[model samples]
Target: MRKTATTLADGRELIYFDDTEPYTSGAATRELRDRRDLDPVAATSTMRYDVLTGEWVTLASHRNSRTFLPAVAECPLCPTRADRPATEIPAEDYDVVVFENRFPSLARGAEPPATDHVDGDDLWPQRPASGRCEVVCFTSDHDLGFAELPLPRVRTVLAALVDRTRALSALPGIAQVYCFENRGEEIGVTLGHPHGQIYAYPALPPRTEALLRQSRAHHARTGRVLLRDVLDAERRSGRRIVATTEHWTAYVPAAARWPVEVHVAPNRDVADLTELRDPELEDLAALYLDVLGRLDRFFDGVGKLPYIAGWHQAPVEEGRELGRLYLQVFSLMRAPHRMKFLAGSESGMGAWISDTTPEAIAARFRAIAPGPVPS
Candidate 1:
């Protein structure tokens, strides 16, 4: 397969992939917007790909369809009571299970794929839809989140992620593996369960592609791995660093795009958690749980503080080796009851304006008590 891409006049990224065996060319396009142009309350849902930048955009208007507060009995992810059947339970006893989504936005059945239209009323060129999404049930217990999970359980969950990445990447048409978890409804999680999502895509994701390209360029110029060098610098500076062990370190990013963004990277370079030794995985998991616990302490045990956590691994392909794996976790909520909404400047202009200082946030996190971990 031959891949080609270029930037558009409007600063959007476009990529195309050509296959010799299949005799087909696949292309994708996307753009960064200032604000979503949709009725968040009225539109049930809509998915679009911005041709200029080459990224998939999913607008879930139904997010605001229901009332803000729902009874615990009505929670879809909750376990069934004595009178209810076992079907009402999200899953049986399992540490982590990957299953097909019941209500996925990128369903295999979503019709009239964006690539079908060469030219429509207002739609510019779009790319074919070729991606699969699976939900990773983190734990059987509804109350156990990443922060609450025992260290050994967290390692099991990370192992599950590694297994899923290896399994999904080996599929016939997968090029990228995206694993992410959204905690709390403030981050738009409908279900209040301890679960995450895995998206095995047929093509390289735009943001991943951009970071990979940047890492390659940086490596070419410096003859050193980008993330490894950055992690070393953070350790040497000892300012933004929040928590660190022999193998891993967690710190506030110097160029954070969000107010409460924290990045956890290996003290040594590794492609993914799968590549780490068992001991290293345990250390990493310990740090992960510690940081999350501090986050909980930061907001005085506000469990509903919305946050997103994900593993950014190198592409599954062999050629994309310059990239290093890292975990990026950020909260949309600036505080317990406050949110940082992406309005006009952030949504339409592709610019981020943060109100708090990274230094201050790092200091605040550092002051929080690091709870003991079993590992």
Candidate 2:
């Protein structure tokens, strides 16, 4: 599966890649293909990369128009429909359910083009597009967000994440697992359900790839994990520490790119939370909940605040201990009621101009005493 150009209805080019098709039998692909339980389902999502912007897009074929604004009475992700057919799941019985996204950004089981590369000055090799996109529903409740769920329930969600990570990482072509949640309509969510998507890619993303290069360089010289040392320094400095436990710490990064960006990283050099022992899993979950609770209290429970949360870890090819696993949450609010906008520098030049300093964001988060568990 390699990327080839396809034209969208709007006449823009959409680069398509189908992972199920053979591309290169590299080490990464071999590992990914072996994970049968989690590989791309028979009817998987379609993926295309944008040639100009270098952004990957997923288009899932299983999703129909009706799946977008489903009524509460017809919510299929709810627990009551565990045994229901694929098309008629009832809503309301599940604690956590992992399913194929109804309207996936990536369509499954697509066929890669026989030849995607063309002789042109602007052309680069299109990487094979193979991977799985899954939505993990956190709860069966129609209106409950992660912050509104009980502590134990939230723990279940985290555990599911770890499980899915492990399952997907074992597949043949997957090079990385990207997990994230986009909350609120401000982030352009088409559904009101409390769920997040997991993407198992055949190669590392550009940002992750860059981080890997930096870490490899650092390790070649210092024989230490860059993130591990950074976590230690941040703990000793204490300027940005939000909360710390035996296994995890939440703090604001000194080089934060957003106004209210909070990160929870493992004190040890664990690539992803999936590698944590059972006991450590609970600690990671506890720390995650602690930070989220703080965020909820900061916003006064309106739940209208928009935010994005994503996990950053070393690529699967880098081994499980190459980098410390961390979660970053960035709030869209830059001022009391105003949202931050990405103008010329950010949108056009790929440069970020932050309005708030990391130190100030850290101080503000520190001032808010950790409130009761969010639920």
Candidate 3:
């Protein structure tokens, strides 16, 4: 793959990842320049450390004014078209594109400066939410989604993700780099576009923090990688396995909290997406695409199932050794016509209530799997 990096009108960076041969030969037809005159990028988001939960909360008031569910003709993620106004992507067509988010919750060099004179206030500790947020466009078309893309195109998307993961991890003050996709309207996806988000967080997120703690404890006790052990247990049990390849495994976790949840982990102990070898990448794409296809087929009457797919990676600064790369895909849809909403037990207490068992979900996934597994 060839990378062509350029700057958007708003001074944000945009990169185009193109495949060799036919795509690169016809690259001249693609838009290489931004036609729109936009203002400079600015971010004032601040993070306040919560001593109670031991997590940072970002206050990005500007995000309230962002575009929400725009019409297809006005979707900012779509490629710039002659029939409509210029969108966020200035390209006429692109196999895959990633650009700095305009309404970002975190940004580079946007950190609040340090104060030397103030007394150490433990109760009101705040810092600049200085980190980068990039939007990964899976394709030029506005109607298609990641799960609907061809395998080759899916590989192209993974290439872009690997590129961004490596690049974002190198940025200063970046602690954790998370790549995630929010699909369907029920998932609170503001934009109905075929795109995912890369958030370079200023600090370790709550979920990653929990994983690091558990993994470190497990490693200290058993002298083995926790995720690898879990994968082994799943394979041995042969009950929750969703799909498997030589280099990857997809399973509905035994303690799955969501109605539909599956975790896809690389067989190797890769710290991040960048460490995935070529063969692993190839098979990862195929197996992930298969898992996604099964997800869409899991429900009958529901159109496109609303789901959140998140990549859990190790922090950039610390505990990377304990970090195991995995993708957690889950949905709140409890049934074909019913949606599970987080109420008092989940929202107020943080305790998840699952309407279905993990084994049942795994059985549904197994039934929809494209091919039968080996004995």
Which candidate leads in TM-score? Answer: 3
RMSD of each: 12.9, 10.6, 3.4
Per-residue CA lDDT of model 2 for 1-375, tens digit only, reads: 232232222222222222222432121222222111222333444445557767654445555543555666555554333343322122223356565553444423445634444332234334335666777777656687776677666666777777778877887777788888888776666667787778777656778766777887889999988788788889999998888888788889989988779988877667786777866777876677667767765644444457788998667875445666889998877765567888899989989999878888888787777656444
Candidate 1 lDDT score at position 373:
23
Q: What are the per-model numbers of colliding residue pairs?
A: 15, 28, 0
Choose 1 or 2, whichever is better by lDDT.
1
lDDT of each: 0.66, 0.65, 0.85
* Comparison by TM-score, 1 against 3, better one: 3
- Tens-place lDDT per residue, model 1, 64-167, is 44433345555444433445432222222334445544444443433444444455635654444445566766655776777887766677677777777887
TM-score list, all predictions = 0.77, 0.78, 0.94
Task: Summarize candidate 3's per-residue lDDT along 277-309 as a digit string, tens digits.
Answer: 999999988887788777887887665788899
Span of 10 residues, lowest total lDDT, candidate 2: 27-36
Winning candidate number (lDDT): 3
Per-residue lDDT, model 1, residue 262, is: 86
Candidate 1 segments exceeding 4 Å error: 1-49, 58-71, 74-82, 86-92, 107-115, 120-123, 300-304, 372-375
